[model samples]
Target: MVANRTRRLSVRNISVVILVLVVIYALVGFVGLPWWLERVLPERLEKHMGWQAEVGDIHVNPFVMSVEVLDLDAEDSDGEPVVAFDRFYTNLGVWRLVTGVVGLQNIELEEPYIRLDLLEDYSVNFARDWQANNPPAEDAPADDSDSAEPMRLQFDRFRVAGGELLFRDFSQEAQEDFRVTPLDLALNDLATWPREDSESNYYLLAAVGSQTIEWEGDLSIAPIYSRGFIKLGGVTHTTLQHFLKPYLPYQLRDGRVTLSTRYELQSADELFLTTSDGQLDIENLGLGLAGHDDELLTADRIRVGDISFGLNSRNVSTGTLDTDGVNLSLYRDADGAINLLEPFRNEADEEPADDSSDTDMPFRWTVAGVELGNSSVNWRDEQPRTGADLSLTDLSISVDELSDQLEEPVNYKADATLGGGGRVVINGQATPAPFTLEAGIAGSDIVLAQFGAYINEAANLDVRDGSLSVDGNLDLDQQQDPLTGTFSGAGEIASLDLRLGDSDERLIGWQTLRLEPIEYNVAPARLEIGTVTLAGPTVNVVRGGDGLH
Candidate 1:
């Protein structure tokens, strides 16, 4: 009877111990772990990073070794949110620890936002003070043989969605601000240790202002190699104007650029980059003179197609370059200097030799073809006493091919209207290496009265109304000491009315005058005329007592 009573007491004691263990497991897994994650973790984070941290809720599943954090926020001393996230979820592979590897099934972040501020001294906001307070630790001598290898890390999947990054620069006077929002990124099967599975498939997409940037392909971190495609669309120049403001004399009023290319990068021995099958487009470009209201240039679009570039080879090639609706403005001030060239005037002083030239490889580039349509140039000359304005409209130019290392001549053609009264056309072939050009030029109905200022200054004569026509061929050779050119032409001047020094009376009048089979050379300054024909000519000369006019 005593033995039976002892046996019952032992069984009761075992039941009590099992019940207590169940209670402890329930409390820690369902309650205590969540509380520590939500409260203690944030406190420790704030203490280490000098930032206030807040977590809305945390959920932990001890059995699965998984964690989920919701509405986490970290703010700087100024109460500015430096980092925030809506949700973070990760699951650890606890069994993998036995194999000396840290493994995660998946890691995900949603609605993560980060703000970065750059100061005038080129320091970032969060790092400025922290780095100053905590200098890098001194390196200690160690024997490599005694060192233990770092633990390997692996993840089946990692993802970020609805991410935003804001970058503000106080270095510029204008305080440039840029933001990338709606950033979505994904990487699959990533591992720190080198293996056949180390090459991860990655994709990134983001919106930068109104633009969209995308990158996708395979990447390996251990060997540092990537092969992918990158596309940038509608990247506005206004967003990046701060980078050019310090170096350019003009203001970038407006523009957008787009580029798409396939790229490969390798960093095993030396860094190398290559891109192929690229296309670039620029649209609605406008440039204006600094501190002036006048626009220097404007273009509707420029496109380059079939581009290939290599960084290590220092080579660039494009199949075609095309442009449309371009306009250029030029002005000559009263001082006989062009306003558009004011910034470059009197720059005869030799420039300092660039040190980089000694270390840098020479670049080689080529363009298969070029086309420009609907372009115009407007020129205003205040040097003329009366101020003259001239316009070249309906201008179109074409080039067959051009390159820095061309052995054959490149063919080109151009056509335009001058001052709404004359038509000009030129066809040429040029070789850049030898610097030679052979061109055929033709012009008709060129009003001579438009050049009255130059005519009056050169010969003390005024031209009221006249028209000139010419057909010619010119060959130029820069190899010559004086940059000589040869011209063979036939020309005619018709309906010319000339006067002397503001006089009302006509000094000379001609119905038609012609010079045929003319040959001119610039170097030796020679002119040969085969025939001179005058249809009707009249001259009025008065011998005044004061002077002979």
Candidate 2:
């Protein structure tokens, strides 16, 4: 009976305690909690961020708070604008209000734009100003400060659908200058108070035209720093390297960058570029440079189907270059301009020497061919000391077509001379002139009647399948008024037939003529055949120099 009474009394006491606790929870949640929150929340946010904010239309059952901003702007103590947002609507997390934590569920901004002008010299100064005015709360200190305890602001997520951040004065004039237009940014998975007094680590994704860049990176809101090392492919701009410097490390300014595809370049193609492993020191910041350091403007190793030539250069002003395997060296003056070629001028070292008599100059020349080997001419004192061996190959000359309607044409094979002594060599078929005929003319027929009329008065003669063959001495004497020569041949003519063709009939027959001597006039184009006797059926006359009819 005692144990039952103790157990029943204990159960009755627990039921009374639970009923009081339930009543208290209901009063705070559905009735008075929202009223107290509306008065207390705005004060806390204004004291923390130094910005004016208003909360309207609070609901307690479903736990919702609608925040509306009439005007919002932040400036440095010097009154320079940092950021501004106007006419904003956002929904707050009701659970956060109950837990005494400030959190937003959804934030919708209507046409907000930010202007950021970061000059090279004033960046650090602006950072200092930002630190001083927005001092950390007593409970949370700023990250960049030296204090052991740091301030932090925590947030679940934040989204901005349409906005623009205009950055001006991002680079020096001579370095890599650029401008970014229409900036739209979105962040996800953001937690502001990541560590003690530290900024958030977020997943960032942004798009510029067709190119989308994404990275898992960390950003510190307190000290204002962010870094995302990522690969951006298919961005085809020759000046992209110059434009990406502000966001990248200083070392990448002169570092090696490997491009996947070759960029078509304008102007002269040859260029030498140095991009080895190096450090870039910009405004006292060190950065690592990586990628290819050679000529950045070449298609040398590109995978194009057919290999074509291209030019690449590092120093366009004064470096050597190669285009399609042709090597060329370029030079420039001190002013960084190309040095132009100068005109021919007399030099001080080439002044004329005092002299009267003409001095003998010595010259040596070598000539050789298949039949003649190693022929040389050494001229001393204007006279040729010549020993030349010359071989004549495929040398032939012939006159075809003797009709009045047609002009006689002479055709000859090309000849090459190799070996001989002296400056002249008499070889091959004998002609009335000093010129040599090739061996191909050995069996050609000769009509003396046509030749006699063209040269001088000569006897009627005929040679069938006969060739004029002569091996003789050639004398060239330019010291006299009229230069002359003699050509003698000892070849027989077969079936000799002679009758100068009249206007009536075409005289045609073969005749044998005796060997004769021909005299040639070197002054003018003339030839004189000596007296000849025809031996055949119409052996008409043995003439001194007359035609036989």
Candidate 3:
């Protein structure tokens, strides 16, 4: 009986010990742990980062080994919001600890927001601020040992939903804003540990204004390789014009671009990137000169297809480029410089630092074909006369092949109608290196009245009303330093009326004046005229401004 009583006493003591342990666990996990975290986390973060951090609430679940932080806000020194999130949750997978891997069962972030600014010198605000606030520590003595092993980490699933990023650039004179809203990201089976299946899958979806962006990819970190498909749908020019402001003086008034590409990247001894099956389309593009109402360039559509590029080899190739209904306006100022090219001229004046090493690895690019249809160009020149305007309409151009290597022949053709009921055609095959061209040029009923300003500027004469027709074949070769070329052509001017520039007196008149055949050769430096025919011709002798005749 005494032994039984001693056993009962031992059992009672064990039960009391178990009850005390339960009470302690409940107090720490359910009551004290979250409060302690809420009080300490803000202080720790501010002390280390020099930024203000706020935590609304923290909850710990002992049963699932999970923790949740709600309503977290982090701000910069200037009280600008850097990062804020509504809810962040993570669950610990304790079993992975046996294999020296810190594993996360699941991690979720909801409604996270980030704000970033880029400065004029291309430095980002967050980085500059952080570096300024936290100076680097002094160098320590080097240890004669191998570096510490990298921590191994694994995540079964990670997700972000309803995220937003506000990006602003102060690089330009005015601030530019770009926002990505409702960004969703997901990743599965991501691990930094050695495993049979090391590849992770990821998907991203986001929108900027009306544009939608999507990316889905498979990545592996051990070997550092990734393959992905990316698409940008209906990105408008207004949303992206700020990116081009530095390079262009014009404003993008209207345009939308759609692009899709498949890409693969590998990081080994040298980084390499390969892209294929790319397509880009631009629709309804209109570019207007800054502070001007008229469009400088406009296009209905431009399409680029079958694009492929390799970064390691520095090669790029495209199958076809097609553009339709393009209209361009070009202007030349009194200084004999194109107004549209002023921006590029200014940029060129700021000479780039020479890098001779880059010359050894030149880029190789080629386009299989190019086609432009239903295009027009309006040219205005303000030299030696009140601005003369010339227009070429209903233009179509085609190039069969073009490449950086200039050894091969490129075949091209162009056809256009002049402003006043005339047509011009040119077809040619050209080699760019030694600069050789064999071509035929023809024009019919080109109006001479429209060329009065040029005639006055060159010869001090005015062309009132006339029609010109020409058919020519030219073979030009610049293989030698001096030009070696031959031109054979026949031309006719009919119903011609000309007058002196200083006075409204007729100087010359002609009807159906023709040169039957004309031939010129560079080798012998000679010109041969076959014949001249004139139906009616008249001329008047006029004294020049110098009073010679």
Candidate 4:
């Protein structure tokens, strides 16, 4: 009986050992199953989703498993290639693997390159093709209502360490149009849903070395929309401003832009803007008809203030110009060839009138408080070398060129105030080159010494409570070298005085020489004088070739 019992015990022990071995075999085989399973898993998925798939060698250990892709090139229904992955690997959860559960711990894609082509028609059918082959479910709606919910694509971590995205619009043929190059983009937060309807928006931050572009804000897939504010700080202010200028509604090729504000849209072909403070440094600006190649009018610096501007009928117009603090320097190259710098006090060149057969050209200028302290303009050829040291306050001048003889002579006027507390009024016709005058001298001493010197003569002059009126004509006739003209002056002298030449030829007396009763004329080479007409002059008159007579 003892022998039989011992044998029974051994048999029971053998049976228990066999059961333990079977369980161990099951566990070991299950844990190692993914090695064999992964080989065919990718094939099954490809067939199911209508994608071409290939797999690399699979690595398996008791605790971990990994599967890598040797190559993958799949196409959507549109036959557009999606992505090319150099190497892709996935790590399996060892705990789940031992229990027969199916899933991966994490998947990693290394250097996956993708190319997308967007058309101008705004149709994104490539995505539709991708979805068709890999349908989500029968209950899924046709429209992208789920897209509003947000899109999340996750991975252990995807790195585009070195890759490029080529996007092109094949429809454009014009060279002047905009084109986008292959931008190297390193993306993160791809797994997070991009906010569409939420008040808080989503963003993508990317960098290429020192240069960085942060594209933050809301994005909508439907209707194809995007709205965001861009703050560019990394690059130099000049370069950044230049790159941003093209996006502006107005062209600023030759201008110093201090600050600017702009708003734009896709559908609307118009742009609204407000400029804070800026100056345009342009040699010349042209404005004309759309197809007409010639420039209708031109100016030196076209300034728009802390100046508001608008584009209407293909012409740029200033809504409000703040000229109080703005200054524009203009240089003109006349003769269309001669290089010259003409700094005008003010200039405005408007478009030629459309209806009027003969274009009416008018120019206006204002030189407030012009201080000509010892300034001179010298002419070499028979032209007068003009020089003056006078201060003119509030000088305004306007000239209009007419085609036909008008009811009134071409309007010309220059108004200013002299430094001697006297108001100067000058009004004349534009045609004869406009003659002006200086008047209103009361209780001021008139110095006739310079006048006498210019005419090679001497005279004693005094004016008390008197009026000095001057009138002149300017002839622009080219026949005469110096352009002959006449200038006349008359003044009232309260006390009479007389003196001519030196002491030997001087005629000094108590005779009253009325200032108003005297007239003077200057021609090409002759100085003519009218009667002095004093009330009490019994003096004899003398004449010489070069002296006052």
Model 2, span 1-549: residue lDDT tens: 999999999999999898888777666766677677666655654455343445553435433555455345554444555455554666667676565556666555644555565556647434545465478689884576665544332355565545555445544554332233233344543443434544444443444444344444456543344544333333333234456644533222222222221123222233322221111111111123244232211211111111112233311111111112111122333343321121112233586877654434322211111121222211112111211112222222222212221122223222222122111233333232333333321222333322333222333322222322333333333334565443333344555334443322224444466545555555575666666656653423343455633
lDDT of 4 by residue, 276-344 (tens): 222322333333322334333333332333222332212122222212211221222223221112212
Model 3 Cα shift for residue 363 (angstroms): 2.6
Report the error of model 1 at residue 478, Å: 1.6
Worst 10 residues of 4 by lDDT: 370-379
User: What is candidate 2's local distance difference test score?
Assistant: 0.39
- Output candidate 1 Cα RMSD: 3.6
lDDT of each: 0.87, 0.39, 0.88, 0.39
lDDT of candidate 3 at residue 390, scale 0 to 100: 89
Model 3, runs deviating above 4 Å: 1-23, 120-146, 194-196, 244-254, 287-295, 344-355, 358-362, 502-507, 522-525, 538-549
Maximum-TM-score candidate? 1
Ranking by TM-score: 1, 3, 4, 2
- Work out the TM-score per prediction: 0.90, 0.30, 0.89, 0.31
Q: Model 1, residue 522: displacement in angstroms?
A: 1.0
RMSD of every prediction: 3.6, 26.6, 3.4, 17.5
lDDT for 430 (candidate 1): 89
lDDT of 2 at 498: 40
Backbone N/Cα/C clashes per model: 0, 31, 0, 0
The model with the greatest lDDT is 3
What is the lDDT, from 0 to 100, of the residue 332 in candidate 4? 24
Of models 1 and 2, which has the larger TM-score? 1
Candidate 1 lDDT at 376 equals: 96
